[model samples]
Target: MVRKKGVYGIAIVALICFLLIVFCTKEPDTVRISHNFQAIEFEDVDVIGEDISIDKIIDTQRLRLERKFDVFKFVTNKTFNKLSMLSGGQPLRTIIVTTWRSGSTFLGDVLNSLPGNYYHYEPLLHYGIMQIRGPPHADTAIKTLKNLLNCDYTDLENYLTFGMSHIYLFTHNKRLWTQCEAYPQYCWNATFLNEFCRLFPFQSMKVVRVRLRLIEELLSDKRLNTKVILLVRDPRGTLQSRRHRDWCPGEPDCDRPDLLCADMVSDYSAAIKFNKMYSRRFRTLRYEDLSLSPYKVVQDLFDWIGINVHPEIKEFLDTHTTVNVGGVSSTYRDSKNVPFHWKNDLNYTEIQSIEATCEEAMKLWGYVKTKGPKLRDFNPLTSYTIK
Candidate 1:
């Protein structure tokens, strides 16, 4: 009986040891790890171990692992809400917000052309897409961008727009995703969007291209010492240019021209309203001024940004400043010698139609009324073609 009892006790001890081993071997379901300016989240971790310190995993391999984990977190969350929270919320240097087709792209391209400037064209679009589809989509966007540019991130970062450069230019698309009825939830979530914008205010300059409507939001960022460049053009010309783009309304190529027109009008009205509200903040310039006096405008812009034009930049400007009408392949046409094309291109009827369609916008922007013989009728269909 004594021997049997001893054997039973040993068996019980073995069972307890087995259970302990099993418990120790089980992996954690989630682990939150943070490192320099970033936090990594790991889910479904298989190894059950004591919590690891970020300091202990500061090497290259660990950093790569952390990045992978971050990608996973981004996918799961489908938002960049936590990015600002990491690194004690480091602020971004600059944010350049603008409406689409308002020479923002040209400005971005020009800024990026300058050395030592980081100009990201439409980064918010990528960010928005990432927010919608998660990390895989973000990765795909990055990869596609890299491929389209025919350069890797390392090479691209050398220029002023791809990475954390000293000078950053961000051209944010003004159209909120929520406007699309199909994806109301994807519209700019103020919390996340504000957080994203707030992350970059520490820079030396935040040059914002303020359309009339978004000035309020631009003003709300008290941290940002905003320099507003209010860009304006004739509503008729604006619509004409807009219609020429493949993405514009009334384009035969567009799947829904009616919706595009409504959206454009809404956007134009918002711009007009914004301009009225923040007229004092703006250094208003006509699109014609930029075209006719490229050098003067560019020099003035440089002064505003507090950058001395390097000799190389000046030389490039001197060569490229002349107006190259009829697309990029055309020869430089001296603005002084060339007659204004609008006089011939825009008929009386077309002008009146444009005025009628965007009278509020024109009045808000301080456009002067012109006297002319009224033409019989205006047909926008004949004036512009979608490329």
Candidate 2:
């Protein structure tokens, strides 16, 4: 009996000590998710849970922004915005500025390969054949772009609908397309599109219509937090690829290498200027270099745009760059050999015309000018580096 009592007393003391120690030790007040650039964040929280915090953040952010945000206004009327990156409310916005047939579709897909992005394919498609040319159209261009970037589809209601020249636009956005396919009722409903767009942390668009000078104002507005990738291609290769398009011949804006080179000259000057001004935000990528080294170029591109190369982006690079060329508008290509494939399509006479017209760009952008040689099959007659 005495031994039993001693053992019980010892056990009780140990239990009490453990309880006191646990009570005295401080527990952390809050925890953080490892990554900060996630869908949403919390300013006040006792516990950190993604689902709970994200919903509260969304409601708070929407209410705060709704006060200053005008439904149908733009850069000319209302200034861009003040939301921080994905960390706060706004998603990162990037525009790929390139001419048609310059592997822009492929490059756009590279950005789209990031897990969650609201991909805008050729937003200027609504502008039709006569792209944004001058003052008459400039305001409209800026306004439209601002609205789209901000996920405000108020004015674009007509263009944002289904079946009438908007199929391609929705279909290109895999996530949106999937949801739309699943729920046809919400396919292009302005409300659905707006909400869907907000869910993403990145917005990517490719525009062949606007010039660098035109977008200077858009980039100036820090609130938009816009970045640009000027994707330039050798006119020789550009014109060759453009030949595949039946409509390009008659459109001066489309096929004429001379006209294209002139635009490039104007844009290239602006590129140099923008490089000095917005070194972190603006990038110039040559199609040849991208094709020659897709992995390295894309990795660098991701870093420049404030992201690491995502696994999906890596898989896209692997599968898309190495596969044989697909449909005319398809992103898949044997990227390594696509640069010089134009040589097989164009004869020396055609090459001379393209080269002569693009001489200044070729020289400035570093393309070795071929005088009278007929080395059509020789891998890219023009060097891919800048002089």
Candidate 3:
């Protein structure tokens, strides 16, 4: 009985010492920004157009917990954020500035395929929807996009439910809740979801619905810490693809030279203008170049984002790259056939109209006019060479 009593007393004493050490340790009370960009603050006005209360849309519990954690860690550990960067686990927010039928789907797929990465697809779809009280302004879209990059869906929840407002943060094919049902392992674990939320290397958004005029406003905001990949396609190809798919229902006839082609030119001009101002954060990619040399192209893109291609992403591309040639709904074709499909599919007048409308962009992007049914051979076997 005496021995038992002594052992119990020792156990209590050891537990006390452990508790004291944990509470007394003094860590530096400063959390440094992991990256070199400035943090941005959102505007006071409600970004969502709905009349509902903000709390209804926001997951207040999650936001509060995140803010509290950020404050607590900032006060307790100076080295915490630095360690995240050093370990190559720092959050990287990326926005792929693109338009419809411009190969953004494939690129978004590649980005989303990367483990620990998130992809938001066309979050600006709410702009055209009438069910929403008002069209989403550039400022509102930019604000919502930035919030999503940080995993804050506060103002975006209501917008995602209405008319043409189907913004996809993960996959467009599957609803947000059904994502886990389709891919179980990729689903968030309730226990570690918070930790998982904080550990991603990339949070990407691909926008095709927003106006090109918004590029400056969106990219100029340094708080976003976003790299904009201005993706362009040969206007001839873009028009042909759009017409074939008829994806944008509200737009005028795509075949009308003034419609799709003019929009393409405007977007390209915006990209060019912004590239001049924010040369460091802006990059322009052409579908022709990407199709001909996807491996080299994405390698450069991945380098711009400061990450090597994830092996699984590479493998996924290897299989999917050749599966669909024209668009998501189109039939499977040789991967090399993608860039040259315009050669066979588009006739002389159609090509001429697109070329005339997109003359400046074609020249700017180095898309030389070719006049042959014969396609230059491109070997898909050389697809993604991992260095």
Candidate 4:
């Protein structure tokens, strides 16, 4: 009887090991590719070099494990949620907060590619440019933003009537304008507002010119239901790009790299504070990370924002994000190459100047300072593909 018991125990142990191996080696389930998926074909030689596999692009083991977990969780949760249709009344309101030259435009464009998206670009920019005391004013700006969230144009129209051309330039949507053209005053009226609100429930605003402190204050307001995407770039990269654009080349304070670095430190400090206060509602996106893996980064971002990664968006990234600067006949640069270009553009002194003030901020945001011109580790050249 004892000998039989030992044999049974050994068989059970062997069975458990066999089951573990089977489960561990099994391939993860793949989501069916929707017919709506679009592929963007590009002829640019610079953008079309040896294709990097998506697996190679996402080399971080931690990130890969998280993504794997997310896939299982996402599938299960999504299947459960599909039992009932989600309502448009409670659409996700997103605020993309960033500083100048932080690639907010690129990120915004990707988010805006989603259907039924109402995008307002830099609504507070006019306030800064016009020296208007209201738009950036916490209460006033918050009120205007609330109206936008509710899809109301009454207050926005009144504000624009003050000859705020800059406001019009940024906030105006050509498609909406065309749709409202037949309406009185070209659909800048109540009926048009109602229809616009009904048609496009999801709203997004990308703000770059606003102060981070004011944004924090606005978000702190419980009445405003919005998620903030704090988009950040390495100070070295942002400053180098700004220098290329001559955005503050002539201004003495702006020309001083140290001052800019200090400002970046302040900005990132505010970001860290805001994130701490609103961890769930506030998500941060780094330009460097996004550049290295656009599809993966975007997938994770969309998942975090309670949305599914749509196929059209993937196509949009391929088509719009990868392109040459000007006289765009064929030549184009891959979007992945956008990050770390500062390495080539900025000199040692410039990088060091940025590092002096932004060291803590850089570390806080997962930016590692290089000992030399380039990072010895973390090579982006890897084979990967996202289907």
Candidate 5:
């Protein structure tokens, strides 16, 4: 009886070892790939030789598209608990709360430039598969975002499931999206994302969907070690930029000031409340101020958030804020003059419409009206005088 029991115990150990090996080497589920999934692509280049001029993008799109895909298997759960990560003394949770065309993307690129920071660009891009439709979806945005910032990818399975039709969604985190760039299969695998997300020390995500009031939960959540940055822009400039994206909405929402200012007014009120409560955890940035004085404002911003300005951000600011400008969605721009670009484009009539609708926001947020004669000359767009 004793010999038989020993043989049975040895058999059980062998079975357990075999199971572990099989689980480790199993092929990724192919059903994870969607038949209707749209292809996601980003423009990039490869260096062919020692010289920069000879560099060219290795054209792999054809080959990449033609190949069959199997999800990339991910292999680690090396993440520490949020308490442990934060108590060890430095993984700060920073979130950018702003709307599109408000220079949020530009600011996002700036913040993500720092090494050791893992950036989740527009994590709320999954609402209805693009952008958040309205406040009714606030709960969804809030829950999903908190999960993302916490490095919990369980809730993000669908968002990362098919990669992203919106390239900027992940491309902003160059360190991350590269893994999915070649074979989107990697992005579809939640296990891969779960492990990838935990590898970063500083986890940050910028969101345009939810309002400032909605962000209060995150600020109050101690487990997150959270900090919020509210970035507001002059309504005129935001509307003007939205006009460039003619295909996008131009109504009581995106391009229109009525709903836009309503949202801002509510957000500003929350900012005031949050400032009094979580002073260190909450801060606001005006796009006009940052654009007008990139270096000073950014450095002050970094200091406020207890982070040193990365050298990469300086190079980014130099490259993007100068003559190397791009289109409506691109982050590249003449940062100093961008805030006033709308001044040259918007006529008195258009300005009147926005200013009238956003009167409360403009006054409360310190954006001076087009009263002075030099309005056309790009005079001071902001003021210390808050009504």
Candidate 6:
């Protein structure tokens, strides 16, 4: 009888240990559910919470869950949102349009670092695809656009129900803009443009920051808020950089008569003509200003758009300084030498041609000219004297 009793006691002890092990191994179901739901929310809208038949109670719970998730997402990704908050609900609609190698990538990286701003690097690709392909169907397009804009269709419809009144920054690669009209079949697809305009009837603002003769041709679209920034460098420096570092495939050959060096006389003639035509709306900032004191110029630009500078902006500027081909440094190693190294690579004739072509732009932007003739009334690009 004693032996049997001892054996029963041992059996009880073993059963308790097994139960404890099982409980420890199992993860909390609630935590698992929450994580899965969040992942689903980010990927697609249809993967939300389980549906409850009762309308009122289910709707309230779903709203609560969404709000909770939104708060979580914001906390996790506060950099962009911080900028949006600084704007007091009027988020920046910035478009960093530029010709190849004009330091737009650098500018974009800086803007992207700011909180609350949605920075799309080369968004023109998406725009082109949509325009050419049209939406898969009306429903799919509506859903995608709403997601892209981060707003509901109802909100967008209400905003554009009236006439065009809002400010939209439409930044594009200069190459894309140049090709849109001339090589219509190559880059022009009206489906996206037509739909976007029809859906959102707001004035489209463009950023033209390169020294190109094509600027005048761009003005045919009267509705464009064409702001030009004739970003220029010393002719010697420009050509050298173009030859060694910044050569883009499929660009016009610099040797061709029609395709003069970007800094040549023809380029300046085009810039001057464009500037005169859109004098009131045009603005220019030098490549030097961008390299040296980017924050000040960018701040002024933000102010122009009525966005008050955040006090924390100084902190961001102090920390981020390196400029690379990809724009911002993904790593913290210092890289200030990248921008100034183009001076060592150009030949004399190349330098002279660049200077000859870009003389007008150089004078306009207050660059000290080396070989080109000076303009009589060459106003500094930043000489926007407010009367």
Clashes of each: 13, 0, 0, 6, 0, 10
Clashing pairs in 6: 79-115, 80-115, 80-116, 81-116, 83-115, 131-192, 263-357, 263-358, 264-357, 265-357
Candidate 5 — what's its lDDT?
Answer: 0.68
Give the RMSD in angstroms, all C-alphas superposed, for model 6: 12.8
Candidate 1 per-residue C-alpha lDDT over 96-131 given as tens digits, one digit per residue, 9 for 90 to 100: 443444454444433433422223344433232112
TM-score of each: 0.43, 0.75, 0.63, 0.64, 0.73, 0.48
Residue 310, model 1: Cα distance from true site in angstroms: 2.7
Estimate, for each residue in 246-299, the C-alpha lDDT of model 3 and write its tens digit: 445456533455655556566666766776787778877776677766777877
Q: lDDT of candidate 2 vs native?
A: 0.71
Output the number of the TM-score-best candidate. Answer: 2
Candidate 2 lDDT, tens digit per residue, 324-381? 7656776778888887766678877888888888888777676665556666545554
Expressed as tens digits, the lDDT of each residue in 1-387 for candidate 6 is 999999999999999999999999997553111212101111112222333222332233334434433543422333332322222222234433344345555565454433333333432222221121122433443333333333222333332322122212222222122222222332223333322222211112222222244444334434333344454444444434445433333345422322333344444555566567766444455555666665778787555543445433444455555433232323221334434444334444554565566665455545554333333333223432111
Q: What lDDT does each candidate get? A: 0.39, 0.71, 0.55, 0.58, 0.68, 0.39
Candidate 6 lowest-lDDT run of ten: 35-44
Q: Which scores higher on lDDT, 2 or 3?
A: 2
Candidate 2's displacement at residue 33, Å, is 30
Pick by lDDT: 2 or 4, better one: 2
Ranking by TM-score: 2, 5, 4, 3, 6, 1
lDDT for each residue of candidate 4 in 1-387, tens digit (9 for 90 to 100): 999999999999999999999999998664222222123211111111134322222222223323433544422244322311122334566888776667787787677666445677666554543212224366777566667666667667544553234434433343343333222243345444544443443567877655566676557767555789877777777777667654467754445555545555566677778767887788767777777788889898887777666566777877755765643112123767676677777777777777777776666666667676565353423222111
The better-scoring model by TM-score among 1 and 2 is 2
Candidate 5 residue lDDT tens string, 202-232: 6678888777887887888887878899999
**Minimal lDDT window, size 10, model 1:** 35-44
Top candidate when judged by lDDT against the true structure: 2
